[model samples]
Target: MYHEQHGAPAVAPLAGFTVGVTAARRADELGALLQRRGAAVLHAPALRIVPLADDGELLAATKELIDNPPDVVVATTAIGFRGWVEAADGWGFGEELLACLRGVELLARGPKVKGAIRAAGLTEEWSPTSESMAEVLDRLLDEGVADRRVALQLHGEPLPGFVEALRAGGAEVVVVPVYRWMPPEDLAPLDRLLDATVGRSLDAVTFTSAPAAASLFSRAEDRGMLPQLLDALAHDVLPACVGPVTALPLQAVGLDTVQP
Candidate 1:
């Protein structure tokens, strides 16, 4: 442990630094944490998590899946799984849906999905170490999906290739998109964040999810500021991510990110 030569008073490590938060869920909590550490937080949620626009289609699909339970069920995200179950319960088919899932071979993409399944009194028979959809699909393919009925809970975004792969394997795939991520209706805050980032005013930007980072980059592209934004992220400002999955897009583009 090293100490100052003159026994200087202690101070917040992040004092005078400004951090940008691009998280939707728990954005306030993150802001509070940074504030407490003496960082000025700039909050600009690039994406807003909204309920599916058309619940009728999802509910009907759930009912059909329950009526003729799929041979395999893939749980992608905890939020999507919980939303699907809760929606079924709202439509009075919760117990039936749970029973149907109980009879199927359950596969989770990650610990979150596994936990969600367990919370619903269901068991997960398989999950991948990477906790990625691609990994989950690979495992399913290796196990043989020919003539199997597979139900997948999507994480809002469309996975056309994944579905195509399953279909090519002779599996009937039913996709359940429980929620969709919509860009922030007001672009003013995001615009401010973009300007500040490029101007080197923000010390760091924290991203909790990949979609949020993508959304921000998409906006910057639309404004023709993507190059400057990337430069800032790569050189001037520190880019932090919650996990590797969330840092994938940033890293792919040659932007180094700090991740826990």
Candidate 2:
């Protein structure tokens, strides 16, 4: 039973619950949302988003792609696409890059990626309903990528295997990494989150990206607490993700997840 105070409703649904947030870009916004629902928030950004401007390799890759446009271009993530465009603009090659992309057959992973491509004054020739990178590769392979030049705008993590798959299909693949995910500079916060998780002090953990989740798992493995952490998450702490893609890693470990 609960009682109201000062005309306010008693016991907000999330009262007495603690939720962990692992988003670097919008961590504060997510924390605020959880707080409004009466939950105590714990933020531990497992991975930090490094912009293309700061990554020399990524900048050079973008330049190479702009200089030599591929026959097909695959845009994976909205933020990654936006970052690539912004970086090229900063380098005084925005127009040239856009023009190059316009000449290529563009493929988007999903609506967000399609929106980013369209926003850049370019159009996507194809997009899959499943919105998965595997699906994107499958469609391209189905269309016969032999002897075609394909450029892929990589998201925050590496996709060497995906590149290999394309290469095996007889396509010359050029990977343009727009951004990357690095472990947080400060590991103290993440350590605390792991402690809480293992102690069953958290009610739920929210992951916005697959890399972040993978980073957390890697860190736990390093500390020899991977089994404990996984057990806690499975039995006590509810794991939540923003989408299926982010849930893939957790699902691989036979852990159930909640996602919108």
Q: Pick the candidate with the highest TM-score.
A: 2
TM-score of each: 0.85, 0.90
Compose the digit string of candidate 2's lDDT tens values, residues 15-46. Answer: 89999998888899999988987899999999
Model 1 CA lDDT for position 242: 90
Model 1 misplaced stretches (Cα beyond 4 Å):
1-7, 52-57, 129-135, 159-170
Candidate 1 total steric clashes: 0
Q: Write the per-residue lDDT of candidate 1 for residues 1-260, one digit (tens) a residue.
A: 12365677556778899999998889999999988878999999988877643566687788789888999999888888988888888888899999999899999988988999999988999888767788988989998999999998876555537889999999999987677678999989999999999999999999988788889999999999999999999998999999866887798799999987
For model 1, give the 10-residue run with minimal summed lDDT: 1-10
Q: Which stretches of candidate 2 lie over 4 Å from their true place?
A: 1-10, 159-161
lDDT of 2 at 138: 84
Give the range of the ten consecutive residues with the poorest summed lDDT in model 2.
154-163
